[model samples]
Target: MSDRDTIHAHIEAHIGEHIANIQRLVQQPSVSLEKTGLRECAALLVSNMMAAGFTEAETVDVGDDYPGVWGMVDCGKPTTMLIYGHYDVRPVGTEAWTHPPFSGEAIPFDGFPKVVLGRGAAAQKGPLQAWINAVSSILSVEGALPVNLIFLIEGAELLGSPNYGKLFERYRDRLAQVSALYGPKTAQDASGAVSMTLGYKGLIYLEFVASTQSTGLGPQGGAVHSATSVVVDNPVWRLLHAMASLTDDTGRTIAIPELAAMMAQAKPIADWERPLLDAMRAGVAGKDPNGFIPGLAPQFPVKTFKEEVAPADLLQRYMYGPSFNISGLRSGYTGPGTKSFLLPDTATATCDLRVISEVGAQDIIAIIRRHLDSAGFPDITIRVMAAYDWYQTSLESSLIRATLATLDAYDCPRTIWPVQGFGGPWAHFAKLLGIPSLQGGSPGHGARLATSDEFLVVEGDGKVASLATIERYYVDLIYAFAAVTKQ
Candidate 1:
């Protein structure tokens, strides 16, 4: 049998182990946002990584609070690759769920023959375990993988990667040796069509806190009675005016001409990427392009998107568009009744700009700062909460070719988004380590990431890849990447 065929067989033989390990991983709650089960999950990952043939696996201190899990498989190969991931799962709030957040039960649900339901099932824990199982299968079948492997199991990915500074301080030297880094999401749409993405947008989270003392706006000292509002300047109004200038009336397009021009200039889609983007937007293999959009229907009660509020072109806006969002706005007291008689001392508005490539976070912040100042809202203080630049991989890189080759080998209908709208700290890999990075992984259909009733489909209905298929795809990808990238 071929080496890959043998590895696939090994994965099949150990499929039960894979599912159980995935369940076990999920059952351990590692919500970094809440500082729960972090080091414990890191320790669990360390144990699994060691068992999966990693030469080294251990939890490293990430500045403080949340610790990161680091592992490496030294196969004595020149080609080394890092798989970036977050072991941390989003917080499981008080929402009622089909199953307990960490139950991790495998049952038939939502048209899939079998699925594992849990808090990180669709988002990460499931996919992360799949990679480990793939590594284990390859090791069991061939005794060694084709290339060296490294793992960065982050714990604070949700918190804008505040721990990245010290995490890099720890892994800088080892990371410098890696040929490339890849984030393997490999999640399939509900329609069984898979999507490929080459890059992720950056993020800038800023909180505008307007107050009498902090920003020199509104009534001095504490809130004055609303009777004085006719003469006194309201900080809330000032914050609103400053934020309103960010976007046009549609609230989708940037109103700032300079920022808009920067995004447009950065958005010249490469010649090769154009076809991939078109394939995604036009739909692939007879699948509806609209199926790729979640929570989209012909109509929904809770405010469906329209061109006025969102872009008319879904792919164009999703891939290259920058989003200006007001996460939270608070100014006054509306507890039981009228506090409207008095103005609040401070008004705070937390917002985020999902930035694109070629636009640095500092530069974006500078632009926003200048815009607010020039618009005569200098009293509005822009407090940067979190900021990270965008990151992308070159289409011409051997790693990119290897990834595409692996995706194509499955013979599944795949669509490609030249770049994803979400944000991650991938640029650190590129700028700090010189390791170009791409995000995605093997095919598997899953849903409800960071929401209620999350699940990863275990059995495919002849279209989507099952967990076993995903593992096999990773095994194939490792060999393919090693083959192309190695001299």
Candidate 2:
């Protein structure tokens, strides 16, 4: 048999073992929200890393927070690659789920192998395990890796990765030596074609709360009954009226004057924008109606019919623009039947603003505060929850060449998104280290990330095939960087 065939067969042979590992990892609840099983999970990963042939693997504790696992495979090569993966996962919503959120049960199906149901099954654990499986297969066949690997597994991404800064500061010297970095949440085309993301947008999440005290109660302060609505100024109506002034009917423009200040700070890079715009149009022909859960449509930022799917409009909105959203709001009683109610003594709303490059979170918050003050809602209270700076990468860098060559070697199709149109922490690496970073992963296809009924169909050769894809791309990346360093 040819070498490729032999390698593929070997990977297929060990597929069950790799899958077992994934099941074990998924079974251990690492939900970051409840602080559940995080340490044990990190230890489990460190053990797996060692078993998979990583020589120096250890779990670094972040004080009271979840520990981040770090490992290195000394390929004895001069060049190094920093690979990042998260072990933490978001808490499963309590209300609806096909299976218990933590139950790692593999349910059998007709055409496909059984799938293990659980949170983090797709968002990361599966893909992370897939990477290890691929690396193990490569070592089994070749007896050595192609280049140096610096793998970092963090357990705090779900909590906004707050401690990442301190962790990076501690290991700055070691991380700085790496040639390039890779992270999770990548996408391939509808036909399983791969693409490289050259850049990403940065983000800032904030919450705004507004409340009216005794003022809305018609000057009679004693929680008046609903029948006296004629005299009382209802807080619900006042809030609705004030919020109406924030956005237009079509949600196209912010009515606040301070929006101009935030807009002026944004600077869109050209090289990153063109390819990103092209990818959106060609990525998916039609938006899947069943892609999201039923009744969850309201949660998505924007819904688009095929007729309104303007690629330019979508691209512009993603990169060089801003979005304002009311995450959630509540005032009066919310339950089964409607009861006679008075204007709530207090009403509150939470808001989040997504900023592109050049927009600072503090600046955006100030603008929002100024606008609320100018709009005569000075009594409203705004609390900033999570603040992050915007970041982007240069598409012309040598790192882009490595990413493109790797994706090309893996047979990633041409029509898929060539770069990330969304935002992440690209600035931390790009702006801080002066080196470009990339975000792409093996987690997009199935319904596992933040959705229920999520399952992974274990095809006979699928695990082997996915591993081989990652191996080719990762090894190609090593060679690509070697060439760059030599030049």
Candidate 3:
């Protein structure tokens, strides 16, 4: 048999072991939001990388409670690519789940044969472990990897990857050899079609806070009777009004004129985006009705866009639209039953805005602040959590070309997205470090990230890729990317 065929068979031969590795990673809790089990998870990953045959694997302190994990395998190849992933995951609140959030059990799913259900299955843990397993198989089968690898998994990706700057400073010398950054998301539809996203939208994550301390107009000495709210200015009501001013009652469009004007003035389409955008108009629109909406539309089959949204307008709104969304809101009396009488002193609303390249995070923050102040809610403070602008990589880049070639070879239908609504710190950090960035993954479908019952499909139908197939595809991607780098 050919060497490629032999390697693919080897992945299947040890598929059970590969799956066990993923489950082990998934079982470890690394919720970054609560600062829970992060160090233990990092240590567990260090052990996993060492077992997977990395020359060196260890976690480095980045001047925070959370640490960044770094690992490298030197196969004596000239070309070196850096793989970026998050070791930390979103906090799983008291939401009901099909299985325990960290069980990592291969349960029988409705559509797919089996899936590993957990908190970080699709977001980071599942894909990260699969990456390690793929490299291990390549080494076992070929005795060496095609390209050298450097893994830089952050523990604070949900916090906008603030520590990445310190990581770059600490590893400046070692990272000089890296050519590009590969941020792998589990990018497969039920039909097994995957998207090659050229760029990602930027993000400004912040919290809107209103309290007696900040506003000085609310109930002062803690709990007050709801009857007193007639005289006392409720901070929660004031904050809600401020939030409402940012959007209409439906909360679909941005009500801030400055932000909308900024969106209109921004570049309609970038030069590098044209090729993929044109391809998307033809490929994604025809292949799927929802047009590559990722985990939400394809998996759940819901109406994500406006009803009867033409592919062009749907793609435009997705690619360039700016948005303001309240991720979470909290005050008093959201418990099992209502605390009808008590009014709390403080209320907070966690929110985020997606920005295109034309818009800036600073601009968004300033606009929000100005709007809130002008709207007579001067005391409501905008607590900036994390912020970064968007970025795009050319289709002609070696990293992207190699990835597309590999996807073609694997027989997975590819849809090229010019840009998507998802936000990540990959663009800011990759550009800051002067490396091209590419985001992709193998032919596996996963869903429910940042929510309950998050899962990654391990066994697939004829269309979707199984765990073994996903691992083998990663191996082929390494070889394909390596070959293109030589040119």
Q: What is the C-alpha lDDT of each candidate?
A: 0.80, 0.63, 0.81
Give per-residue CA lDDT, model 3, range 1-487, as digits (tens). Answer: 9888888888899889988888888898988878999999999999999998899899989778789999999988888999888889888866788788899898887577898888888888888888898888877878888899999888988876767767767887888899888877788977778867777788888899888988677778587888887887788887888889988778887888877777666657867677767776665464455435543544456555454677665666767777677889998777796678877898999988887855577777998899888989889888877777788777788888888888888888877777778777676555666667877745778887856898999998888888888888888888898899988
Whichever of 1 and 2 has more lDDT, that candidate is: 1
- Assess every candidate by TM-score: 0.86, 0.74, 0.86
TM-score of model number 1:
0.86
Pick out the ten consecutive residues of candidate 3 with the lowest summed lDDT. 290-299
What is candidate 1's lDDT per residue for 1-487, written digit by digit as tens?
8888988998998898999999999999998878999989999999999888889999998568889888998989888999888888888866679889899999998888999999988778888889999999988888888999989878988777767657766888888888888777845877666766677788787799777786565667778888888878778877777778888987878888778888776567778877777766555334433544533442323344445332226546666877888878988785776666887778898887887757688898998888888878787788876677887777777777887788789876666566777776777887666667877745898887756888998888788889999988989889999889765
Best by lDDT: 3
Candidate 2's C-alpha lDDT?
0.63
Candidate 2 residue-wise lDDT, 1-487, digit = tens: 9654565577678866877887888888898878999999999998888888886889988786678888888778776777778888878864488678767666653233466567887667866776676666667777666667788777877666656666677688987877777664435423464444555545555544445453433433334566667866666666666677788876666777767655666564466566666656454335443232122343464465323545445444454566676767876666678756555555667665665646466677787788777888776666655556655546566666666665566555533233343444445666677776776633223344676655444442342224334434444455566676566
Model 3, runs deviating above 4 Å: 1-10, 33-36, 61-66, 75-77, 89-101, 111-114, 141-144, 156-176, 248-252, 255-257, 270-272, 282-292, 295-312, 333-336, 373-378, 448-454
Q: How much lDDT does candidate 3 score?
A: 0.81
